[model samples]
Target: MLNDRYDNPLTTRSQSARDAYVEGVDSILSANGDGIGLLQGAVQADDSFALAHAALARALQISARGAEAVAAITKARALAAGISGRERGHINMLGHLIDGDGALAYAAALDHLAAFPRDALIAQPLTGVFGLIGFSGLSGREAEQLAFLAQLAPHYGEDWWFGTQFAFAQIEVGQADRALQTIECALERNPCSAHGAHVRAHIHYERGETEAGLAYLGEWRRDYQRRGVLYCHISWHVALWMLERGDAAAAWRIIDDCVRPGKVWGPPLNVLTDTASFLHRAELMGGAPQPERWREVSEFARQLFPKPGIAFADVHAALAHAMSGETDALAKLIAEPVGPAGEVVAALAQVFAAFARQDWTESIALLAPVMATHERIGGSRAQRDLLEFSLVAALLKAGRPDDARLTLISRRPKKVGARAVAGL
Candidate 1:
């Protein structure tokens, strides 16, 4: 009865199994290399290790390998009967999540966290922007995320994995100054911390440190393997900064190389959302609409996200559909939005369609009403900036430069310089 790195008791007695499981958990928590493979090794070392199968299931689910994830979780559930209480709870939580029962999964995660606050794997799904809580479609989720991390802070003192996540929570809650300090110290402790690097990049974006962000991420991206969980999204950040710096070719190159539909080796969720967000953001900055690229992403959305439950991905899928002239698909998304933020998703779907048609007034009319509740769509402020800039673009296109100016000043005064609309 050895323990995990977090001191959670393991049911398996194999040292090799325990070691690989720990490494795999570290990989997942840090957004680094080969967690699934490591967990597979752990399972191979001890097939009875219920947590290894559960970890593999969760990793596969996060990587968008749905069928494999289901298989793994099923195995984990079959083995859960003999494991510790903490292990059984962990397996069940991930099972609910992988099976698309998010409400149950979320409730189970909170309950598990209350009993085992140091179970970073259980808490991982509730931490980041795309986590259960972050994408819960609940308003004030950002504040909730911060509070969730804050309460667990004392349990994970000086742990780089927890620090990176906690600092990101701070950044999302508009505490960038403090997040900067936290992430900097975290990164200093683990220089190649992918989660830390991503959080640091967000702080840079928050403070409008365009050139510095581009340079730092440019260097950081070189060593970060493509297999890393955060690779595509992190590359999205680099491309975005390059686009903002007027290095359009470099930006497009990154999109083509690492962030596009056919090219990206990351999660399908990341592929759909990042490509659609970057392409439209690039278009607002006067970049020509690449119909072929739009078609690729729209097709990607069609095949992968046939029915969108995640509100953030749904809106981007709608954008890709609208931009690619997949009117039937776009119309379907607008008519049948899903999840807690379905109302906001529906409106934004129409907004994207209107914007695609150059119906600026319609876009604005549809978009403005959802502005107050857009947080329910679930993404970090940096990722959701696509919507903010879209409104600015719509206002400019509708011969409402003054309104656009006021909107920028009133809502995102600090990001005015980063708004991409030509007239603005």
Candidate 2:
């Protein structure tokens, strides 16, 4: 068995393969696209490298190559028969994740970490995909995520990546001061950490610090590679902040330059959904997005529909189709089975559809029940704000000024003026 940079066991006998595998893990921790190639190199260097294959499966899974991820993990499982306990745990963790059993994967990761605390591969599942820190099905995931990270501090003392992940969980749980300090420490260790930068963005967004958020991303993104996993999503943050600043044109410019359909990097599903959401939100604000843009997103959504178990993606797809005037496509997407997590997304879709028809009362009714449950769909507090915006807008349009005023007063930041209510 070979060991990773943190001295975690890897089921690879070849030294070159081990090095490539470690590099791949590091790339993933940094959110670099190079991780995919590095992990592929590891497997190429040694076909029997079970741990490398497992890690590669995770990378492929995040990249939306679901079939390839299944193949890679299947190969990993076959080779795992002879690996050490730690390596087997890694394989098990990734295998469960590939199988879409997030709870099982998370359980395996917890067990793996208890035995081998330095295994960052095991830790990845608790952040990126069905992460406890981000979009997780577990109730009170934030508190559990923070407690878990705190418990692991002794195992990963002063590690930059751990700090970044911990800081993100901190931000989610309303520990902003600690999150800021932790992320700053992480950035001090490696300024190029895209994950740290992302956490910082979340910190700003959650606090409603729009200008600080913009300046931070503008400076940090100057050095961030567009090919990385987070560039488009981070750019989406910038666009959102620009909208918050009342610079609708600036928001559209960022979308056109970095996040628009056919122009952005990262997963097609993620980029197109974010682009479509931005366009729809802009239109709601009375800022005109080019109709062709909506059509482009509609085309992308059509390609991804009928595979709608992920609620976040489904909600965005519905937005794309509805905005583009593809009523038939929208209805078909709504009718697809999205599971319980998708329930709120489906309701939000109905809200949008009703709002489009100027049926404000129906829109308000559809939106009211889903507002609290929207978080169950696993987007950031920032991403889920789109749903809140819809609710407020529908309330106003329904002539429920008292209700809209109460919503804005309770939910929106005190800094924002009447423009948010004035349709941009």
Candidate 3:
């Protein structure tokens, strides 16, 4: 007999249903399995309840049931048709979860707001989706998204989610100083926002404050664990930091504990495979014990390279060959033509191979054009950093000290770490 109090029905039963929906939302946030079951029951009883569907979709996404999450979001959108105010805003938020392309999701949210002018729920998804888009390496798209969100920031003052996203975008465009300022503002407004903390940790990492970055990540991990959710992206960043510091064993342990078991929403398997490949290369550089996991990851990469949507797999495979001293394998990978981004990665992989072989001249030759066109190279800052470091190292090893010094001077102001110094 329960019905939503806000619905057409005007009775105690409707009031009870409204209370149930509220309880369901709270339960899902608290990671209660029974709460999700109750939400399903409530949605079955009232197919027009948009909140219940959106909440259910969020839970499903957290559980890694992407297809089910999409279905739930579809239902929520249908139920929210012609609705305005918070209900429509919630629908837009759920739309972000279902849309794979970040730009498309932002557009859809903007369309929803064109109808509902004073919607508060729009801020949460807009910020989160924009942050993820920035990570996907489209700086232009990220700037546009941030500008759109900034227009609403005045009306939505102290929005921690939006502030964190703005910080993340700043980091993407090599503006670490601005990113640090924005993240500090976010933490001042909401110290409990994990995304804000994660951004702050990266800023610290970029500044070569490795210990501070590790501490920040520790706090973020503990906070998410207490909330019964895991932020896999932060964990991945921690792993990378550890690898950079020549602690491959510690990096491997972090990935094994948090990422490999699928306990969290980590990167796709292929991406993790690439991380493992890099860790193996780090181990070789640091004289650490060879990890058996590297071979397993290599096999995974080999299987993944032939599949579409796994363009980065080629780079990982090439790195694996370079690390293992398999010149023939490396040559084959580098010789194969690829897209613009892929071509850059392939050229950079050749630099790694040449460096490993101590062929400094060939390494410099391979990397010069890539470095000259670095601005036009389409990939994340992380990928570009790898290529830039290789080029600087090759220039130094080839005895072009002046060119190496100039490259270091030009880039070191923007980036940090020994890789930028290239032994100068």
For each of the candidates, the C-alpha root-mean-square deviation to the true structure, in angstroms, is 1.3, 2.6, 6.1
- Candidate 3 lDDT, 132-227, residue by residue in tens: 333233326456555766676665455455567677667765678888888888889767655677678767766767667877787666656422
Cα error of candidate 2 at position 344, Å = 1.7
Cα shift from native, residue 258, model 1 (Å): 0.6
TM-scores across all candidates? 0.97, 0.90, 0.68
Question: Which regions of candidate 3 are displaced past 4 Å?
Answer: 1-47, 58-64, 77-82, 85-106, 113-132, 135-142, 174-178, 226-230, 242-249, 260-265, 269-292, 301-306, 310-384, 396-405, 414-424
List model 1 lDDT by residue over 162-181, tens digit each: 88998999988889888988
Scored by CA lDDT, what does every candidate get?
Answer: 0.89, 0.78, 0.58
lDDT of 2: 0.78
Show where candidate 2 strays beyond 4 Å.
128-139, 289-291, 333-337, 414-424
Best by TM-score: 1
Better of 1 and 2 by TM-score: 1
Question: How far does residue 31 in candidate 3 sit from its true spot (Å)?
Answer: 12
